[model samples]
Target: MLTIPKELPAGFEAYGRSTDFTPDNLPARLQAAHSTKAGTWGLLHVLEGKILYQLEAPFEGEQLAAAGEKIVIESEVPHRVKFVERGRFFVEFYRKAELTPG
Candidate 1:
């Protein structure tokens, strides 16, 4: 039960609402995947328990995270995540309009 931002700008879209899961209640050999729309970014925050995540790109970083840790990644940046313990959390997906001028 968390309130997430729903405000989106032009060329940006939110594919779906935030998702929550409990590790203790999840079946073994389970993994969740979300596809990102082009020109978009995704954010995931751990509100409880711990988890391990790895981004299959230059943003690669792996470690165990406890409550209050957050991870942000851009679209097409393949990543994998696993729950370390039974807990609650939220994941948000957002799209960006344009790339910043280099």
Candidate 2:
């Protein structure tokens, strides 16, 4: 069974986001197994249609996310995505917020 975190860990903040992508425009790198850098997390938001998310070794499994749904990617976890139907989506990255002395 695939387990997705219900939310990002506390103290993490959004750092960046990817351009909206459709199946035709999805990057090659995202279609193959890849992982986020240490301390980084990713939220894959589906805007339209459906997508297949596959988690590689150590957490091997797959889940399908549809429009209005999202998938949380844990830091350093190997995973990949593909179109289950024509879809539009974007990935928002997050990392621990840096402490600032006030």
In candidate 1, how many Å is residue 76 off? 0.8
lDDT of 2 by residue, 1-102 (tens): 557687899999998999999978899999999999999999999999999989987787777999999988989989999999997999999999999999
Query: After TM-score superposition, what is the CA distance of residue 52 in candidate 2 from its true location, in Å?
Result: 1.1
Clashes of each: 0, 0
After superposition, which runs of candidate 1 have C-alpha atoms over 4 Å from their true positions? 1-16, 24-35, 57-60, 97-102
| Residue range 1-102, candidate 1, lDDT tens digits | 122223334566555546576775543422544335567776667889887766544354565668997665456555567888767666777765456799
Among these predictions, the greatest lDDT belongs to 2
lDDT of 1 at 87: 76
Of candidate 2, the 10-residue stretch with the lowest lDDT total is 1-10
Instruction: List the global CA lDDT of all models.
Output: 0.61, 0.91
Error of 1 at 1 (Å): 37
User: What's each prediction's TM-score?
Assistant: 0.60, 0.92
Those runs of model 2 whose alpha carbons end farther than 4 Å from true positions after fitting are none
Q: How far off is residue 60 in model 2, in Å?
A: 1.6
